[model samples]
Target chain A: MEAASVLERRNFNGLLDALTARGYRPIGPVLEAGRIVYGPIQRDSDLPIGKTDIHDGGMYRIADRPDDALFGYNLPSDSWKQYLFPPHSRLWTATKSNGSFTVAAEEIDPPRYALLGVRACELAAIRVQDTVFTGAFPDRQYNAVRDDVLIVGVNCGQAGGTCFCTSMGTGPQLTDGYDLVLTELLDGDHRFLVRSGTATGADILRELPLTPATPADCAEAEALIEHVSGHMGRMLDTDGIKDLLYDNAEHERWDDVATRCLACANCTMVCPTCFCVTTEDRPTLDGATAERWRTWDSCFSLGFSHIHGGPIRTSVKARYRQWMTHKLATWIDQFGTSGCVGCGRCITWCPVGIDITHEVAAIRTEEAVHAHR
Target chain B: MRKPKLAVWKFASCDGCQLSLLDAEDELLAVAGAVEIANFPEASREVLPGPYQLSLVEGSITTPHDAERIQQVRSESEFLVTIGACATAGGIQALRNWADVAEFTRSVYATPEFIDTLDTSTAIADHVTVDFELRGCPINKGQLLEVVNAFLYGRRPDIPGYSVCIECKRRGTTCVMVADGTPCLGPVTQAGCGALCPAYHRGCYGCFGPAESANLPALISELRRLEVDDATLVRALRTYNAYAPEFRAASDELEVTG
Candidate 1:
């Protein structure tokens, strides 16, 4: 793959301008409401340049970085799922009148999106969603948006307090699933080491002002990625974790965590990979027409597992157990991978700061002690 | 044939349970076809006069007006089915029952004199004769269909009142409590969700409320032996269906020790 470099911090803006010129809407991370939110970005100024985020369970705050690094930010509160599988999207519409029912197919106009500054973990999360929404049944709506999306993955030069992508084997560096991968190098010169994983990214690189990467620059990028990985704030022992969680369902650690869990579902809501959703119908002013919409759902909601006459997981303890188990254990069965991306968003965003990594560790340690005894 | 008149009524809830009925996309059209939908205000603006064949009631009776309205709904409906935890068993809002109503009113409302709530949020069965009760925080659509289909076919609904453990066994899901030593409510929870939590590798949270013949004392003892604290046990029973007699009894039992 061809590689190049761009020194113009405004080169990102130029790329957006070029994309806009070529009739593609540029969507990327923009500073919104004290947090980095994914929205339409027209220029480099819209990017969270030199701005980093402090992410913990349920809490997200944006902080200013000392340097003018455009792609220096960590994962934002919003994931690419918002663009692919939106919170509220019309699936279809139905009308009933005159003793007959008429159904109209919803006009799904998937906007041509250029996702700028997607972190590697988020890219991995997108791939996980792809397997879900596109793999088996191939959700037409999700596929429509995803098929046209141009992914611009930014390698993490800085890790967030809540980031554990290294543990999940998904992030801190961009590997694939992106049109372009930009590594912001900080060696006296302000430049981005651009690498193309796809032909589209190569085409974009070809269009941008660039210089051939020296062997030293490539080494610098690799060293930077390694440094970021080493500095991961948290880690999870995923080896045999599925079996461990599957086997220790009676572990007292869960009960301890349950005491603190408010069951507010803030963790699942902020989770980049949590994909459970439910649909509802809203009637217009006229009683004849109704619109069906899909919304994000959480397992923590007692209503999520309600059956004929009652909820299956009526207790907060049970709901919390279901969520964690699905994320860690059963996710392996369903998706052939852990549902959790080790992003640590669940821990940071949890109202009571219930750390999944800590909980898992406690369970494992307790089990080990029991076995030794 | 004229569609059966369908009425959706709310008592006291977060509106999430009623939202579940509207959430049915794949079956909503078919449901509409099978019913007149005479008074579903959430999904329709037109409120036709009801002598409804099927009334899907959400929430619990938490006020004097609601207590009266439930009777009217029962009188006007052939089959009155309560949906969700609130209707079947007083919902999480039933947490208000633990504290003094006067204190609660004073805390929540600026003018307690204007408040018209009852001392406690009680299930629909407490006020009127309910034909059926769908369990859940938000009723499961699959079981909701089973209830509707049974009514349409003029047969008894085949909703299982057995423990969630049965469903787990049927689904070949390993017991998280047994295999993993995970504290679960599967042994006491009514089965209807087909053991989703267990299938997902988690313990059952007893969302289906209590199963018939639930051995609460034994389960509580076993949980304690497994190192579950009294506070944890109490919190578990005080969720969605906390006000239900069985769960309420179990929670009260736990509270006695503390």
Candidate 2:
């Protein structure tokens, strides 16, 4: 049953307490370095209440929102992927003795997490990663943390200057992929209109000091989502975009973008579903133990495409094309869904203002190549 | 198998890169066990001669005498690997490359006649072929160990050529340039120092030098958009690895001398 309840902002800490009481370490968006970052939060005060984010192409700043709303920020610099699919993880270790060695698996059982303030786009991103990690060949590390984690998704009450969740069809509303979803109602009463998406969510909500949400409360929540829907900071024309990317493999826009693209891997790293990783055997100088670790690798890295002799995608143009095409086009073929969740972290976090939306638009326009020349 | 003989040599540097080997304190024990220290004047007084399996050169070719010595050192070692910015990109001393050495000596030194130095401070690669080159101002000790370990095991040194942005993202450092409007060189600077400056809320000094896809002009334009002046940007590029081809070229292009 999708039971909706009204949770007072004053008693939000009780929700955190309920989760913690049930042995869940809550991870949420906290203010860090004048930016919103996903980190561990113990109580309500830990959340960036009264703060919202200002995000644009290559620009982001956290500013005081007019009112105090806990989940006021839209997209955080970090994705939920870092918690599930960690950037650096040891896969295995080998110890040597008398010219022969034995390898052992680095099996680990991580703690259960209650991911609070997860956005709809972030939830969608998690679902995409779930398929990537669990399908065909499963990643042991990802599945270990993914299985028992509880997600507390927050619907978009505010949209940043880089948001395009409306176009991506991933957000502004929480449809699925969350245990409990919260819609922070900041109008007159500082309260949250909470709903349970799953049985666990219902149980958790039952423990919280919640009052029954009226139809008006639900309607207001719906209206807020609708308002956010019309206020997307960015938009993309995804109509036949997959085919367009496939056909425009030789587009000169790639070269044009290359001139501005740092190939710094910020986009892929900030991306919720970019799962490319490279493993290195780190043997200590003593020749005793060697750890084989798989760290997050990006196609932007020249070494990412390295074979026996040298890297295949050596040029910035080739790397940029590979990332964009794979993300927009080939990813659908591989995972049956577009890789981008429209969080716009890639655009916001890039040092240069290289907007993927603009790139797609440029490719779609017939005169874009001619205009570039 | 006999432990490979390792030699550490210096030319023109602050010796911080040489100290990085000593700074690998716990790892130094492992390094000592793995290789025979044939020559390391900084760490030891006793020096063993020639035909070393590995030579870790730590400085730039700045003097006429050191220029010929590097060639002699190159011939004695099976594999010659440059250890820091000095060896890889001529370090901060390479700032002399743009300035007149005679004028510099006359201004800084009491006796200009005794100061016999090359006008230009060039990287080891400019003088002799380098088997491998490690970047960074002082070089990361962990990476230093990894390089040494790789050579011992006969494998390719897995040094990344990506920007500091990747490292910042990996380590969960907020993008200083994007988030705080701080003029950072992380996007153009190579990944090595674990995005150190950004973590501390300071812009990257470009100590590790230009990345594989620096795209300096684009980065500079963005920095300019952030209201960073050309003089400050040029100063950022002319730090530790000033003579690094990409940084040098970009700095020269953007140099706003009053």
Off by over 4 Å in 1: A57-59, A95-103, A281-291, B1-258
**Least accurate 10 contiguous residues by lDDT in model 2 chain B:** B249-258
Looking at model 2 chain A, which ten-residue stretch has the lowest summed lDDT?
A: A364-373
> Which candidate wins on TM-score?
2
Q: Candidate 2: deviation at residue A148, Å?
A: 1.1
In candidate 2, which residue pairs clash?
none
The Cα RMSD in angstroms, rounded to one decimal, for candidate 2 relative to the true structure is 1.9
Compare the candidates by DockQ and give the number of the best one: 2
Model 1 docking category: incorrect
lDDT of each: 0.78, 0.90
Per-residue lDDT of candidate 2, residues A166-256 (tens digit): 8999988999878999999987888999989888999998898899999999999999999999999999989998889998889988989
User: Which stretch of 10 consecutive residues in model 1 chain A shows the poorest summed lDDT?
Assistant: A279-288
TM-score of the second chain in each model? 0.95, 0.97
Q: Please tell me which predicted candidate would have the highest lDDT against the true structure.
A: 2
Write the residue-wise lDDT of candidate 1 on B27-52 in tens digits. Answer: 78877777777998889899999799
Q: On a 0 to 100 scale, what is the lDDT of residue A89 in model 1?
A: 74
Error of 2 at B21 (Å): 0.9
